[model samples]
Target: MPKMGFKKLFFFKPSPPPLSVSNNTFSDSLMEENIETARSVITECESQSPPLFTNTRQQAKQYLHAVITLQSTMQYLVERDSSSQKLVKAQFLMQIAMKRLQTEFYRILAENRDCLDPESVSGISSTDHQSSVSDYDDDFPEDDFQFAGDSFSTVAMADLKAIAECMVSAGYSKECVKIYILTRKSIVDEALYHLGVERFSFSQLQKMEWEVLETKIKYWLNAVRVATGTLFPGERALCDFIFGSPEKKIAESCFAEICREGAMSLFGFPENVAKCKKTSEKMFRTLDLYEAISDNWQHIESIFSFESTTSIRSQAVASQVRLGEAVRTMLMDFESAIQKESSKIPVPGGGIHPLTRYVMNYIAFLADYSNALADIVADWPKNPLPESYFQSPDRDGNNRSPEVVERFAWLILVLLCKLDAKAELYKDVALSYLFLANNMQYVVVKVRNSNLGFLLGDDWLTKHEAKVKEYVSKYERFGWSKVLALLPENPPAEMAMEQAKAIFQSFNAAVEETCRAQSSWVVSDPKLRDEIKVWIASKLVQRYWEYYEKYRGGLESVIRFSPDKLGNYLYEIVLFRAEESGSVSSHSASPPHRFKRS
Candidate 1:
């Protein structure tokens, strides 16, 4: 994949810095008190006959609840004083509490295995229980917590200080790993609830207090460097807790920070680049998995549309179709805007600008892609058809209806004629029209079996021919020498141009005679008439500068010919003449004034 362009890449916005923590002895005392309370609870749980309570179920629930409450309180302290020594102390104490709870729960279950019946067991098996306990113990190795000295009084003060210092330094990572490990265990236990003691540690971690643990983990991972000096084994698991679990917002913040800070450089310590290679691979793998599952357009739409589950294949196809349609709509708007501008005159020249022509060609290409995608999406099997009996159509059977293709062809030709007559940007505009004609031919061929073919084959072709002849006749009678000269040559331009102008004049006379003879014709929809007027005015204004620039020669002549004329002659003629009453008396005469040409 190509790297994203710098212009398109969004920059990371930094968050406000965390509040300062006062390093007072009072703060330390408070932290010590919280740790002591937590320790007392853990010790009490450890000393119970079955380690916590008489009944395994009751003891499991009580111990689980106590761990949750203590964890919550510890989290509160951490958030309240994130950088304080007390907060560090509370984090370690929380880990000890979590460890004791897990140990007692495991010990009780193991001792009471005989009491456990198959009926009481849910998804839990002996293997699962052992795995959960083992993973938990791995996070907090026994040697890390054990006191080896025979007499506490005889222990050297220096040794005690060294141990405390190590604990403080290791506190954040240890607590994070334990939380990650125990959280996984709790999920298994919950899934195996009927087995006996369903741990609530997982449920407890879902609380807002979990953010404190996550923040500490993020800070530590971004600060420390071990021998290999990379994020530890459980780092991704903790990330999963933040992102994959229900606390999505927290995870988003964490992951966004990782991405922003350049996770590889966050720790800023001398370590092998290869140290983070595995962790980076794992992180990217997880991200890829998430994107695969979450970014499907069909899945996203289903969330809103109340649809039945679609097969993965169909979902993938629908996602592509949705994207194609979005691109088509955007391209269409761009084309329409350009077309509106191209209608305007170029400066000093009596035609459209060359840049406008370039834009139109690009827009035409976009339109072609849009139409192609639409056809592809339309023919994709919405309702499955058996393949064994299918046969591809031959040229005769595949040929589009002549009328439909002819109509589109004529429309393209008419647009070309108008563009060639009026636009200075002739080359690309001409090429674009040719491309449009070719694609329309393809569309006709593709949709031959559909109603679009019938329209192109008969109705469109007849209407197009009639409209062209009518416009030609009107142009001739109006003494538009340029229009007559510019008539297409392949079909005998001169003869057709003459007959067209006569027919146009006759049609205008007949329509006026009929309308004046009937009052009802004059009373037709006022709102519609107003809307038409507004639409014409908007188109004119949008193309005013372009048209004036392109057709400056002809426009200046018209302006000079009728100096007092309120609207440009071409504008009035194009917009109003076709719809005007035929009676010469009813027609508003052009201003008689004439001015010298510039």
Candidate 2:
């Protein structure tokens, strides 16, 4: 047992050397009641050479309570003391007693923090313990709460933070704040290092760094919440601490670094299209992370004022801008990568290269931006899409002629043109029309299926539809004109059997040439294909029927023109167009025995 010598020290009061009548007041003695018991404890320490050893932890805690109460008593006395010398002595003694009991109280807590029945060791009532310790011993207690090497340091910190809570209850707000700052810094640094933010270098990225970064960011933000709430204990104060000057600066700096990394990851995507495809995928993963930030953005704004000095807008608003930049960067990279790929295969090719389909599809998936596209598409009208919407040369207000309502739509129009031009490059003109049809049809279908269609209005779809029809008409003119030319003019009713056979063979040859040439062509729009099919079937079926009826029997059985095959040939001819033969459903099964001379 150590000697607690201060007991006697207070009793052996020095002779009153100083007298100041001007400052002496009745209140001084009144305060003595609050501090007298604490002063009397020193008298016991003086009579004993050393304090008796406590038999159990409970006794030690009683001694700790005596010491702690003595500190508060001394502080109360010091504030009332009129003499400067008395004040200094009182303050010094209070510090010593506080330091000693703090060590003692905490040591007991550390030794018995586990197992059971902690109050018995501390001698603190359950109510006192709740106010002193339980505040920080929250559910799902953090394991790595403090120093990793110390087995019980985490619990010790919890206990310490709980003690801080007691101080807060005692109205030591500044002291509580200091504790909060220290705890917050420690937790954040530990989280950042554990999640690898310490080595978060952007230019030289390691795989999965973003994942680690995101995890750490969540931990850090939550730590800030818990920390600020503990220290300030109100809605407004949390906002000021989280989004205010120094702390907000720290969060923004971290976010800025993250954005730098994200930009490097997305904007500086590899030149190769395959790599870009993977990059596009990786870029979208950031979307979720960004969405989390966006959610925070919304969450914080609602809780925090925007116009107030402490508002998040003053600092964290950059998060919104950074999110926008990431989105724009991704969109720009997508277009550039596809355009770069387009350069690989020159425009004006007859058939779209498979890579072209792949690149086009990449944009198709990005159609999640469909609403944005709708906004852009709405700007351009169905009639005369202007080359540019220029502002008033004549000083008119907002006078952009044919004002480009939607820039994104304009971008899509460019892509459409690029697709058209690429299809044009195909030497097989028929195949080129098919490529255009497929690309155009895919876009129209996607827009209609998504909300983008409404914003674009019906005109956009109608115009593109007309464009598709024009392309189909061009295809028919290019691919089937020769076959159409073989529509037999009204056969001379008296024509010789040999002449009729020769004309039928010519007609059969023309039909065979057309079918063989276009057997594999594809038109993706079912309606567009049906239109072309009807056109070809009308030109061939009715004319061939007339010609067959006019001449089938005129070709005598002796000529062996194989009258048995005419119906079958006619059926096959009308049911054509390689994509689908069944749209031409009206072909008669049998040729009429129209051998009577018409």
Candidate 3:
């Protein structure tokens, strides 16, 4: 484990008073005097020695010492007179001490805020609002890490721990947690204000998040654990303070903020998984949240502490029989959002957006943890299977998983279905076919190349490859039919000139339309792309070649368009790259033209 930034502050159990002292009789006057001074102890803690309480650490140490002393005196008196008026006095003073710490910490930190982090004083706002000022451009100095000059941390950490100890020692677990919550809010708000958290870059946000979690929060949790976990059966415990009844006690130790906005909300996690997935910029945000939360959970798990990070990671996961309910909740929303957009995603002019590959890439990412995803589906309510299972695969020989579908596999299948459906909307059939071919080919290759193949079981790629062929076959039909028109069965020899003119017109139209349109189209794979260009070229040139020779009788007859010009026409129609459009000239060579990958 990496060393935490904060100095280690261990919690210790104070030994009980000697038996001789316990048996000592207390006069009513002395007992009354001790109870009267119990409240005054808090005042004397600061008043008696002003210098001792100057800094935060000093104030906390003395503050805790006074609280403990008052409690002991109060308890001793209460034992002799179980319903003493002074005991009530002692209780009120303890509450006063708690209130003072809470109020003073806020004020002291607020006043000295500039000394801790000047930038934060400006950008950090009230907890209710998130600051939009970005701290991204600032170069954080290494001095920020050493924290040698930090007057606030010393006071906050020490006093916070002291108060928690005093509370736990007095059997106030609820107050202990409340103290922790208040201390956390103060520390987090200070850091956030300083870091301009609301507008932090990803790198800055992650750096500070880990620092706060592993150090400050870690210390607070450890202190509470030591206070609560160390008590004997008769002694009061931290957990006891939290949940008094056995039935009411929960295994989880979630904080207020975690129960509300979640642990990552402070780190700028988007409002929801569905929201993050839809905004292309937030594409990887949920995955990042999962990873961060997962790691923090491990950090806590190494010990026995369960806290905010657990809830953050676990919020999406459902319990009950559906252990994977949380995972399904996050992923299912993503599936819905992506599928909705896939059909609507316009094929840009002749080019495909990188988004076409995102679905499969994300699937590959999901596939990395296929076992986890599979577990979720394995436990879903075993109602009758949805109709999606029986629906014939959309032209892709791929069918739904016959067994409980792994989340990743199910999502990928949905994407494939969407891709196929989207392809049908392209106004240009050849372009639509190319888009389908590109996406299908990409999905197949990605699955075969990654562990996605393992999760999806056998024949995932083979089935999608069959879909690619279906697309290719459709493309060939749409593209080649135009070229086939160039050789219109038989030309009447009776009206030779008129027949020749009609063939030339049809030939020009087909050549220009097919070439110009296809030249701009994209095919994602190198091998498949080359195969497509060759396939189209072969069909076009073979028939054109025969017509050119028979009609050319070598230009003895007046032909308006030259046979040599066919090469120029072919060259212009096959523009490959956007960059090559400026320089490429028409073909002067023979007509078995195979184009390069665009």
Candidate 4:
């Protein structure tokens, strides 16, 4: 059942006087009558078949009234005549009332455990507590006890509060507080245990394997959410409501003592996990721990606000700090790993490098945690990148990316610099340029397609895309410069027939030699590959065709290629050609084929 609020039960200090008496100064007859009435009510409540506050709530109020009256009567007697038999008898009646009240208090807390559980009580809201003294007056019609409310939890909480007030007023707080702490503490402990939160020494964590530790970390991530989001808040609400108002200090003290050790154990686990060996592979788990604490920090501060429970809050903060340190260390180690790449073997066909794939994928995953990383590396020192490194204009103060963006961009820069060094392993200058283009394009695509695209922004992508074009331009210039340099500057300029035949023979040999050599060099991106092929064809085919038409009148014996043959050779540059589909007699040869841009 949903809970009802209990704010009305928390009464202020200097408790009101008994309903039967206006003041402490009572006449002898009035005092005797009050004492007799209190005795009779206590006697009947103790002997009643049903327990107090369950079926007979009206009688429960009568018992509470008698207890308060007996307490007042005893005080009045002590002030009037400390040695009189009346004072001693009133003290005896007060003892009986206190004993009866203690029994009911413990009984109500024990039997109403489910209704008074932290989860149920915390569900009670301020709006649900709008019922006033007049509202309860309408229900019971008893002016002496107006603590009753509309729901199961409301009635139970109201009864407990009344009993607690009477017991504390009668100097029986030790008994009342002891029962409360013991019962509630057990519930908190059991809930935590079922949630899989356990106390582990640093030695246990240190000795655990990564796989074992990772499982525990995953469980801790989920357990911390439940413990902070629901468990601790619920407990705090229950403690505050029951022992509230005049005895709020008692409530704080009780809660701190009960939950202090468990909370300390819970928040301290991440710190111990941080102390484990830092590896590039372990960084994500460490980051997960940091994010969990960061997400729940506000609740941690508010629920553990007591001075006595400050250590719980401190422990949570310490875990976040330690996890941050671990992440920073792992990131630095990852950068060093990138810089330390020493493999001499060039990628076959000038395709993407393995180092490039690994680092780009790693950085892309890191960008998924950009917000956490921004906080982690906020204070960590890093070298500033040069202004020329970025190609776009977003680097100004007004449009700068966050520290995480700068950090990620820097990591990609390191990978690119390492790739530049690796490119030197290729003896062919054109092939080295091809290798750089392939890897740089892979890195740019990885960033553009992932969360890195948002963190690094389009400006970063624009800068890198320009870099890919630079590498492609260099590859085309150096890889095909020899073939283009052999053609005449002016194809139609008058020249001797012998010189023209010599030029045609030399040009044909150079084109075949260049195409045969470049046939094996690879561009991994299909779009970029087709683009490079078409660009080479446009330059070479146009110039070669111009020279061929001008000199083809009587040089058929020397000319080995028509424009169509050259176009077919260009089509077969990067990959094998498809087989002819049918007999050649069905083909029309009217117009020569030419490579065109897509």
Best by lDDT: 4
Clashes of 1: 26
Candidate 3: clashing pairs of residues:
56-155, 57-155, 120-193, 120-194, 228-238, 316-326, 317-326, 318-326
Q: Which candidate is the best by TM-score?
A: 4
- Tens digits of per-residue lDDT, candidate 4, 296-397, equal 888899889889898899899998999998898899999998888777777665767777767887788787678789788888665577767753234455
User: Which lDDT values do the candidates have, in the order given?
Assistant: 0.32, 0.43, 0.47, 0.73
State residue 462's C-alpha deviation in candidate 4, in Å: 3.0
User: Tens digits of per-residue lDDT for model 3 on 182-294?
Assistant: 43345444444333323334344345543342243333323323212221110112122222322223213423331223123332332232221133222233333333333
User: Candidate 1: worst 10 consecutive residues by lDDT?
Assistant: 125-134
Runs with alpha carbons beyond 4 Å of true place in candidate 3: 1-326, 342-345, 353-355, 375-377, 381-405, 488-505, 556-598
- Arranged by TM-score with the best first, the candidates are 4, 2, 3, 1
Backbone clash total for model 2 is 10
Record all residue pairs in model 4 with backbone atoms less than 3 Å apart, i.e. clashing. Answer: none
Please give each candidate's TM-score.
Answer: 0.21, 0.56, 0.43, 0.80
lDDT of 4 at 251: 73
Worst 10 residues of 2 by lDDT: 589-598
lDDT of 2: 0.43
In model 2, pairs of residues that clash are 7-42, 7-43, 348-424, 348-425, 348-426, 349-425, 349-426, 350-425, 350-426, 376-406
User: 430-539, model 1: which lDDT tens digit per residue?
Assistant: 22332222223323333343444343344443443344344323322332222322322232323444454443344334433322322121111233234433543343
Residue-by-residue lDDT tens digits, candidate 2, 368-429: 44433333333444434453421112223432222222433554565776776677567777
Better of 2 and 4 by lDDT: 4
